[model samples]
Target: MEAFVQSKREDTAKEPSLFLLPEWMEADKRLTAGFTGRGGGVSAEPWTGLNIGLHVGDDEEAVILNRKRVTEALGWPFEAWTCTEQVHGSRVAQVTLAERGKGRERMDDTIAGCDALMTDVPGVLLTSFYADCVPLYFYAPEAGAVALAHAGWRGTVGGIAARTAEAMASAYGVRPDQILAAIGPSIGDCCYEVDGLVVTEVDRVMDELKLPEGERESCMQRKKNGKASLNLKELNRQIMIKAGILPSRIELTTWCTGCRTDLFYSYRVEGGKTGRMASWIGLQER
Candidate 1:
């Protein structure tokens, strides 16, 4: 079954039209986690609707309003919303109460120099934006912790998934076995083609993981023309498994952002000028 369930609504602008983690993963109601879609917002043109990215050339006011709309739909406080300036690096920042709402309204206010954010502190709704790059989620409910990572090819090769798990274990004593990780919607192997430098980095990651030939072939397939189609979502899943998280504990989404442009924003297909969706995971305060 798909981990991310799309909530149906009549008008996206009037209600929350986003993908949600099913109840099985959030049975306690203590955790609120999911990814946003490209509907139910006020952005125009290439950004279309619900572009929740401040750095994507969308109107700043529209991006802020769209973000507020998302929080409102999630029944989370707008003031609790937090974000980062994703540089596609593997740095993970530990968010605290003081950092809550840091970048809710302006890009300048965003937590700088990080591609990932985690928190054991409740009420800090950790979020990161995405167009085609992968969005990774980590939840250690036992320690009241959760994390969100933006893994482009660079971050993936850098082992951001393992880094995030290590951060949780160090800061909150949350073991990797106890972590529930999820790879959210992004461009699937069916649509993402790469070559040259991109291929070289991926090759290195495969070697580091010591993945078997079969597994490596599935993660990235070489085309007849020498280019390769990369499966970033699967690659991240393997990273989590290698980090000691049980394979059964990780949730992988099959929703390909590139194939579902009507419901998602695809940087490659959308001609580079596109909006961004958001991945959020946080523990609401009791």
Candidate 2:
């Protein structure tokens, strides 16, 4: 079953379309976790709708409005919307009260130079932008902790998944086995073709993984044209498994952003200039 469930709704300007992860949210009413879709925002073309990225070329006012709409839909206070300046690295920042709402309005004050954010601080909604790259979410309910990570191929090679788990352990004493993880919507192997540099780096990571031959082939397959089809989601899941997260506790989404352009913004298919979706997870104060 898909982990991210798209709630059906009209694409009106008032409410943005959302794909929610109820496995975490419903289990604990205080938690709000979901990914935004490509509709129902006020951004102009290229970004078009619901573009929650301030880094993108979308107008400042439009991007801010779109983010406000998402916060409104989640019934979360806009002040709790914390974000990161994603550099496609493995760095994870431990968000605290000081970092709360750091990047909601503009880019100048966002948490700098981080692709992953974890917080035990309630009311700090952690967010990261995406437009095909994987969004990995982490939660340790017993520890009152939640994390949001943005992993592109670069971050994947840098082992961001394991790094995130380690950060949670160090900062919150949350064991990897106790962590609940979800790999959100991203480019699937069916549409993610790669060559040269990507293929070489992926090879290095796979060798480090030391996966069995059959299991290895499932993650990446070379094509007749010398390009390889990479299953980033599967590979990231394996990385999480290697980090000690139980396979049974992980939920992987089947939505392929590259193929679902109507419902998502594909940075690859929608041309290089396009909008980005937001992956958010946080716990409200009791």
**lDDT tens string, model 1, 1-286?**
8989999877766664689887534575878889999988899997989899888888998888888888988888899999999998999999988899988898899999999999988788999999999999998878888999999999998999999999999999999999988999999999999999999999998999999999998899998998999999999999999999999999899999999999999999989999999999888778
Candidate with maximal lDDT: 2
lDDT of 1: 0.91
The ten-residue window of minimal lDDT in model 1 covers 22-31
- What's model 2's overall lDDT? 0.93
**TM-scores of the models, in the order given:** 0.97, 0.98
> For residues 1-286, could you state the per-residue lDDT of candidate 2 as single tens digits?
8899987766455589899998788899999998999889999997888898888888999999888988988898899999999999999999999999998998999999999999999999999999999999999999999999999999998999999999999999999999999999999999899999999998998899898898789889999999999999999999999999999999999999999999999998877799999999999999
List lDDT for all candidates, in order.
Answer: 0.91, 0.93
The CA lDDT at 263 in model 1 is: 91
> What shift in Å separates residue 235 of candidate 2 from its native position after superposition?
0.6
How many clashes does each candidate structure show, in the order listed? 0, 0
